[model samples]
Target: MKKPGRLLGSVSAAAFAILASSPALASGTLAGSTITNTVTVNYQVGSVAQTATSASNSFKVDRKVNVTVAETGSATTQVSPGQTAAVTTFTVTNLSNAALDFALVAAQQSGGTAAHSGTDNFDVTNVKIYVDTNNNGSYDPGTDLEVSYLDEVAADASKTVFVVADIPLSLSTGSVAGVTLTATGREGGTAGSQGAALVETTGADSANTVDTVFADGAGSSDSARDAAYSAKDDYTVLAAALTIVKSSKVISDPLNGTTNPKAIPGATIEYCISVANAAGGAGASNVAISDPLPVTVTYDSGYGIFLNGTVTSGVCNADGAAGGSYSSGTVSGTLSSVAAGATKTMRFRAVIN
Candidate 1:
């Protein structure tokens, strides 16, 4: 259970002396660099200067493997249904004493608590991972290179990553999809190609070579000292939700007029269709309604039609414009727009043939 950074028995206590000296750098000392300390003893023998004696001790600095993955934004990413290429950003920082490569992975939560303050109710499609090659802190489709791993990131440096995915059209408002980003540490020394996976040095440390240590802390999803870290982000749907309702009533009859009219052969009937959008949702545009006349009913040309009316107390008001038309035994009308939490209705009169 001993940690990796400890000075092992490869060098005796008497041989390597502990000192307050080491190669210092702003970021950190190089992994394999040697640190040597020498002490010289000067004395006088019988009031005469004697030959000076000196002893030197040296050891290689061990490699410390550490990394951190953090989600960039403070809140969940807001997205709409059927949205494409929605991006969630993260930052991967190398905290090790040496440059390293990091393998990237983006995963989705099946169904559970999301990274934010809501429950994950759905999963996004076409998920992909990309690196910010230009370091612009934003994702550009063709400009930012899509990558599976980061190459040779220097010590104490950070790189930006993006997780892009498509939102399914079936999602509803307030639905959430959670995603996690993980980066695993890897060996780094070559110029272009990715290095092999990193393994912790076990048992005694070699006297001459540098030992590897996993010193990273636990992240949102990964365990501590595992040479990997993870962070979570989520997307919430904010699309319009529309609902339609149609109602009809017997207005009058050829014999009774407006007095207790029955569904006689010459009865007059009125139809009202209401379209409503849920609150806190996006506005709906170009809303159109169509109703075809039944075999036993005929459109009343004298009464005409009403479009873009209002609904109150579950009843359609006649305060709409005369814009609807009847063609081929069908009534059709179009509303310019419907705001959120608002309802627009279409009304028309027909005769019972």
Candidate 2:
């Protein structure tokens, strides 16, 4: 047969030059995986030698979408303007191999200028986002998983998300706010469906060598493969503004001296107490400040109980010398720090016995 028709056209031109110089075995496998190849052919009938084998087709890899976001805790937290700020966890991972559906959004960031400048603009109230469900990363309101988005993850699986916010009592006291959390990739619609398509680039093509399943670059919207993810956190607000004042003076008056003062039975009063702080506010740690002993007066202990006038009745300082503490009738003090507009004073001496 003309030497088997030139030996089948020299085995089809050597299998098209070994598949055009081995382009990675005809690229195509990963994603949903499947690749099988086999080929063999030898000829020499004149010498009674021949062999031919080839039959094995399988190459199907398509379906790739990725996602990853993290900020699981303590990215910076501390709040009290209306309270309720301590839950900014996030996990959302599904480096997709298949089975995907995610969509969740939350934003509240402003022109920040660092440390209490314009206070970084503010707006945080009620905001909530949940899905931890027993994975025990915390936030168990009714046994976890309260989805507003994100239904199926499986395929590298991972989902912890939680945002819970509320710091707006008029926010101000070193005010600061920034919170962003986004995760999108709702391929075929289902959870709150809205015609999803943040990913899934149509089998992604690079000349489609049998569909090589996006190694990044198909219809690539590139969010690391369109699974998309974003995360940011920060909330700071700590307020403190205090003020108190009380006064009385008419020292020594056996009956009525120091300008017609008469508390009867050997009078002698001198009670003052002032404690102020409120400039930019926020700075009043451990500051005690107590006072109680007025059954009509009768505490003198040699004219004791003085802080700024310093009789050393129990230490309290602000140039008032010593830190603070008094006993019995109570006249406590402990101003570890009170700056902001600063002011501290406490004096004592009474008798109407």
Q: Pick the candidate with the highest TM-score.
A: 1
TM, every model: 0.78, 0.38
Worst 10 residues of 1 by lDDT: 1-10
lDDT of 2 by residue, 112-167 (tens): 65222334677787888888878879887777765667776666778888888878
For this target, which candidate reaches the highest lDDT against the unseen true structure? 1
Structure candidate 1, residue pairs in collision: none
The local distance difference test score of model 2 is 0.62
TM-score, candidate 1, is 0.78
Encode model 1's per-residue lDDT on 1-353: one tens digit a residue. 21223333133343344432555543367788776655556889999999987655567888999899999979999998899999999999999999999999999988889999789999999999999988899999999988889999998899999999999998888999999999999989586777899999998876468999999999878999999999999999888889999998899999999998988999999989999999998888889888988889999889888888899987888778898788998899998788989999888898898
| Candidates' C-alpha lDDT | 0.87, 0.62
